[model samples]
Target chain A: MNHVIEIDGLTKDYGEGRGVFDVNLTVEPGEIFGLVGINGSGKTTTIRHLMGYLRPQKGTCSIEGRNCWKHAAELKKHIGHVPGEISFPDVRTGMDFFNLQARYLGIRDKTRVNSLIDRFNLDASAPLKRMSKGMKQKTAIVAGFMADAPILLLDEGTTGLDPLMQKVFTELVQEEKAQGRTMFMSSHMFDELEATCDRVAFLKEGRIIDVVDMSLLGGNEPVKEYKVEFTSDEDYQTFLAQSFLVKRHRDDYKQVSVLLSDRDLNALFASLSGLDVRYITQVPRTLEDQFKEKYQESEGTNHAY
Target chain B: MPINSALLRQTTRENVTLWGVLTAVQCLLVGVIGMTAPIAAAGIAYYNMLPGIFMGVYAITVGNKLISSQVDRGTLAYVLSNPVKRSTVIVTQVVFFAGSLLAMCTLSAVAHSLGAYFSTFGANSAEIQTIFKLNLGLFTLALSFAGIVFAASCLFNLSKYTIAVGGGIVCAFLLFPIMAMFGSKFAFLSNLTVVSLYKVGSIMASGTGWAWDLVILAAIGLVAFAAGGVAFVRRDLPL
Candidate 1:
């Protein structure tokens, strides 16, 4: 199967150790691939390479089997992009901008543009200079998606959108996915990717640390975690001594969070039977938790986005 | 060169205001002087410095706005994201820059021509030819200034740097010739700048020698404009 977007050993060095290095990714046709990283983690840099705005110091990027840098102008016809930074050209209003883009794309039909304005709840008549951040983001979103291109490369597309609007954007992405449009989006928002992406890649210090299959995420895993607090220090020590996988331990609070498979549930209960416990509750693990763990594993520090 | 009509329209809309103001100012200055004073007396004063200053202002400001300002603002992403190539964009801007400057000079030439024709001290054919020639020389000079600035605009990613280098060069060119007027010792400074190529004294005296100078000016503009466009096409855009 041919990948809609393929990046091989992509590298861009900005000096002082501040650029993407040996990054590789491939998005299967029609798949929604997500890139999640903290600020300065090379998310934007990677997207810029795909956009052909910056030439990679090494390696190459291709979309629909054409080199991104070599065939940038031709390839862009089928790709919709929401840049990391949004800046409207010299135009009077949002409508003027949309119209200008339509001209560039040779889209004479006004119906698609008008429908997009209505869908985003944008005041197309409002001057671009007076627009709020959220409004500007909506305009960029509309521009990126309005063409109904077969592929989308969105770099932090929903920066200033409200929660409700982000939901609208998510629904739009899902709708586009249903129509078999390939999407490769980068975001700092974990839940957004979790909700829409088929697979997500984590980038750290300009290199991809991991690529996770959404199916292997905590929500679908049979291995559940339970946080248990003991009534006394002796019980806490006794519970810790039990060979269950200890995911977390708080000695001062007499709490131990243990991971247990469905088949091991009976064994966990038998072990706690003789112990005096204060309370036990299921502790849900999310992508955020996994990301934090991965981040700390590599950096040995608890910095998070 | 490929030129997108939409981009051309947008470029025109972005720059027409400054072009209009400067062209009108030039036409007014030339018209008033040619109509009110004798052609020979007003020729040196009007053609020598005022038009050059106006051209400098227009070229410096509009040249920066054409390329570097759009990139600096990141607005160019919208254009580049479309199917249009970077070559098409730079070419379209060059067309706008060259065309607008030509129009500005042509209109001012017509204004001065009519002003001289209708003046109480009616002009001869030689004087009328000098007026047209002087404006033609101004047009080439403006092109040269714009070309240098356009190249700077394409070479840099920021508008400030474009203005500092390109605009700075043009301002220096305009100032050098004026500074040389202070004394013969400073006259050598005039040769250092491109504006000296205009040779207003030669043009005003109906000498054919000024035509060759205009060719050099035109060549500079063409070379600079082409260099700017090629630079824009070859370099990486942050957009």
Candidate 2:
């Protein structure tokens, strides 16, 4: 796989303030990689380092095999970055900002810019200072997309958008992905990432705790959850004896829920073959739960891989 | 060169109008003063000193903030992120500030010279030329002060107290000649005085050349400028 971003032992400190410590991660080309963390968990600081806004005190951060600080201008040309905070002086209108950014990026696509403005439902003539937060976010989104760079680095890109706007943003990301764009989005919202990102890196206390491939959750053999209603105590005891069961919750002896891993689900079903299976529901784990598990594991030890 | 031209055009359009209007207003006020009192034409030279002093003080106080505001506003990162070199940004700032100062000083000098030319009774050609030469020297002296202070501002991120102290130090330097006249025995302090350059100008006005002093002062200004450029390229922007 062609890696678009390669961060190796990237460490930065802010003189007694909070910053990243020995972060390492690789984002592949055309992949949507999510960086999930709470506020002040070094998400912004890491993004800043990637954007070449801050130099790492130790280690290296490279984009497409180019050192970020040494080759910032060249790297920036291929990376469209949206800062966590969207702030422009009062004089710049949405259109004016687009024009300025386009000129700077050396993009001559008037059609692309117009399409982005229309799709985002942004008032091109509205001054940024006078616009609402949602409108400003839309404007920033338009600018980021209009650059048409191979990589998109979004820092809290969905903060002020409404639900419909967020849906539009997801659609836009899909379109970018279709065009083979690599997107690295840092967000606090797991659902957004769940719907869009292929992989996620869970960050906690200035370190990456876990890196998960969402596609691996259910491989050829799918993990399934079953809420079995036992007729008597004998049935419950028989199900508990099976080794494929990963977790079981039994409030009373009548009903019990079992969570099985993908590998063990087939064996578990074989044990229940020819028996009256009350109900077999294949429920996938929500991104929130997976993220929580990763976060929990990361709190005790560093498990970035 | 094209990119530099485009950047320069943008900066000029933004800064020139304000600088021009203020300069015109100062010139008109001085012209009115010189025209109203013909016998006090010698005093008009002293009156011209007011605006020159104001310009020096304003440049020292405002130049650093103007350059540093780009960093504060987060625009410096955006600009640096472009394909332009760090040297280009520093050079652009120096050119912008220098051009604005030169334009304003030229306008002020012309207005003051014309006022002095028309108002003086029995004034010879030599006297008029001498006064013009003095004003030119004054402009250079004032620009040097601005350049030095601008360099200092770029060198250190001054706090409120530091700014106050800088202002106090500048005021003392400008007022050193007056202080020296009042029985201060520290004769070596004259070398540190900008007003002493005006005396040099006065002496040189009578067909003499203080080329060595001018060369030394020009070297000081150039050094300050070079230092400002070095500081700009090395200082990390606020994250």
Candidate 3:
């Protein structure tokens, strides 16, 4: 299938180990694809290349089959972007800046822009210079989405946003996806990606080490992990001997983490009935946990959590 | 259109204040000098030096603001992310810069002419022509200075580098002419700088010979502007 966005063997070496290296990814139509990495992990560099702000040192990237570098301006007609940095052009207020952008994008309709402004609950009257980081980010978000372009390339689009606002952003992303828009967003925030992305790529030391399809990850899995603590060591030891898969156990705390499929959930509760059970809580297998495991494994270090 | 009118409007809004203040000061200086002093005296005293300094300062600051400072601040990313092309942005800015400079010189010329026309001595057409020639020469020299700084502005992502190189070139040009004033040995220094091409002496002497120098100054400006525009369009922007 032809990708909405395709990056193949894309490399941009800023020297001293500071650039993206031979990265490859493709976002299908209506998919929300994410690039996740720590700071300086080449996320922004990759986005900039897609934005055509940098020429690839090796290989090429394209949007809708057209080269990003050669057809950047033309491609912009169908794409919206939120730069990593939030500095705005010389404009007094957020509304003015949006108006200017609207003019450039040639969007005569203010309905989408006004709706986005309202949805974000942004006070467009505030002076941009005085706006806080979160406010500026919201302004950038509104600008990026207001164009209603079919594709968006966002570099850390949720930085400085409050948790509630981040939810709003994710909901916005989901809504856009429902409308059949494709997004290629980069963020270090795992939860944001986990909530919305269909697939997430882990970028480490300038290279894409892994791209995990979200459907295959924890939340969608049939198996679940539960951490149970027993009042007595005998109960903990006995629980460990059960048919349940023991993911890990703590001797001092008398706790055992059990992995059980949904069908075995009744069996788990039935067996735990006789034990001097203190507390039993489900341990969610989050994307952070998965990323942490992969991240540590790739670094050849133990960042035990 | 190669020029985005919306971007042009934004660029003009950002720059008009500075252009206004500088243009006002230049016009006032030319007017006051022409009103009180003779053409030959004003040519040597005012036109030969002061206007060049003002232009140099204005050119250095605005040239950076036009392209390099935007790139440095990462604001250019916002501009570029839109449907607007790099050539569109560069060309629109150049049009604004060239237009503003042209307007500055034109206004100053009018002020000088009016000042001489209303002076107690009531200047002749010959002397009035000299005022226009002097300001015209000043305009071309400043435009060339604008071009150099603009090229520097386009070539670098940092304003410090743009100011250092572009501002440095204008300063050197302005300095060379003053250094030439010290003595005969330094007289050769005037030939080394573009400011000398303004030729206040030649214009004050007569209008005929100074036209070629003005053409050279204009040509230098065109070339610099072209190089800067091409560099901005072709080079990779970190933004």
Candidate 4:
């Protein structure tokens, strides 16, 4: 499959259901993959395995066909990483850190660094220990993206950035994506994942629930969902008796959510004609909604899998 | 070597201020006391006890902060993310630390020589040689102490545990000698500490046994540092 990053049965058991279990994943070249999970759900654990910071207990993680643990130093040359926690060294200022990193990474070009600083509006002259949380995050972002490596790994990539800065960061990521750079990122914000990821994996209780292709959720002719509240009780009953699929309903508010394919718009309009409707609004079926559905479905099965 | 260069520079810059203060205190102690007290007594107090204690403190600080503290605070991930081997990081720290100790010891020796010349009203070659031998003993002792704490740093993931065990052993090494000075009963305790390997009075009296002292001290240092390297390479970092 020409996978740039591969994990086969990677398991690290900290005991008491606290670690990743048999996580198998493959990220193809130039693919933007996203890992979505709440805190302590093994997202960071999986990323640390990929970074070679933690050794797997059972299986192997590799990058470009080299074992992550055995050839970590060599593999690092091809990877740029932004850790979940931002902790700078004892360097006096951000510029000092950047220069140190440049020398360590053997990067002779400083132009990329200066441009990243300008794009993020970062103050590289300020002392690292004294910088605010947002500034520290921005500095880490600049450092990670400046090298322009073919493969990038970011854990909670935009946690502390303000809305405007988050927009800038996502724009930078999109540009990297457009250049065919392979990326694996984890985030708490579903919108960020939906905006940049080709495929997103949901992790729950240290297990991967599913990996969803964004295209499958309706690419060009995406399915549309709507919530309509009929003004009259009789109209609401009549609409409920129709053949349209009612995904959810609120009896008190006389509102029902209906899922329809893009081609079914005319049929939907015809079905609603001459009906006393109070209001109708489109319901965006986001990554969060998918995540919630997966969780609910899993619970409903009662360990059927 | 390139990977180590940047790390060395950063460590040196962060450590210079505290090192400067230690150096000034050391130079002043040997330079001032050597002019007033008997040369032998001055060497024992300023050269043997004072610098030994200071070096012990410095060794523990470097040993703990250089690796374990960074790991505990999650900062080591940044350094390891670069194209640097784990072995390279530990080796670079040991080299930088040993060089700093050697420089401080040499400066102490120079300060001691200056004091001895003024006290004797002439340049006493014999006293200067005695100071040089004593400084060598102190440097090796310092190296041994550093290796011990550094090994502790490598064996543990948490800085608190490293500091507790490493700092406790160093404290005992420092205290045993001070207590031994009171009487003969406590003198046996000195043999249990590295400070006993540095026989300042006996070395100055005979002038020929300093070779064996250096060898033993070097042996202690090499063994401890090698053990530390193995532990660090084999250990799994939680970051």
Q: Taking the tens digit of each residue's C-alpha lDDT, what string does model 3 give over B1-239?
A: 48888888888899889889988998888888878888788889888778899889889989999999999999998888987789888888888888888899889999988887887767898888888888788889988999999999999999999999999999999999889989999999988899878888888884488899999999999899999999888898989
DockQ of each: 0.75, 0.38, 0.75, 0.68
User: Which regions of candidate 1 fall more than 4 Å away from where they truly are?
Assistant: A222-241, A249-256, A260-284, A300-305, B123-126, B205-207
In candidate 2 the C-alpha lDDT for residue B226 amounts to 76
| Candidates arranged by lDDT, highest first | 1, 3, 4, 2
Query: Which residue pairs come into collision in candidate 3?
Result: none
Worst 10 residues of 3 chain B by lDDT: B199-208
- Over 4 Å off, model 2: A89-92, A217-238, A248-259, A273-278, A302-305, B1-10, B33-49, B60-62, B117-135, B152-204, B207-218
> Candidate 1: lDDT over CA atoms?
0.90
lDDT per residue (tens digit) for residues A73-95 in model 2: 67877888777866553236888
Task: Tell me which residue pairs clash in candidate 4.
Answer: none
Model 3, residue A149: what's the lDDT? 94
DockQ of 2: 0.38
- Which ten contiguous residues of candidate 2 chain A have the minimum total lDDT? A216-225
How good is the docking of model 2, by CAPRI class? Answer: acceptable
Runs of candidate 3 with Cα error greater than 4 angstroms are A222-245, A252-255, A258-284, A301-305
Candidate 4: Cα lDDT at B197 = 85
DockQ: the better of candidates 1 and 4? 1
Cα TM-score per model: 0.92, 0.85, 0.92, 0.91
The 0-to-1 C-alpha lDDT of every candidate, in the order given, reads 0.90, 0.69, 0.90, 0.87
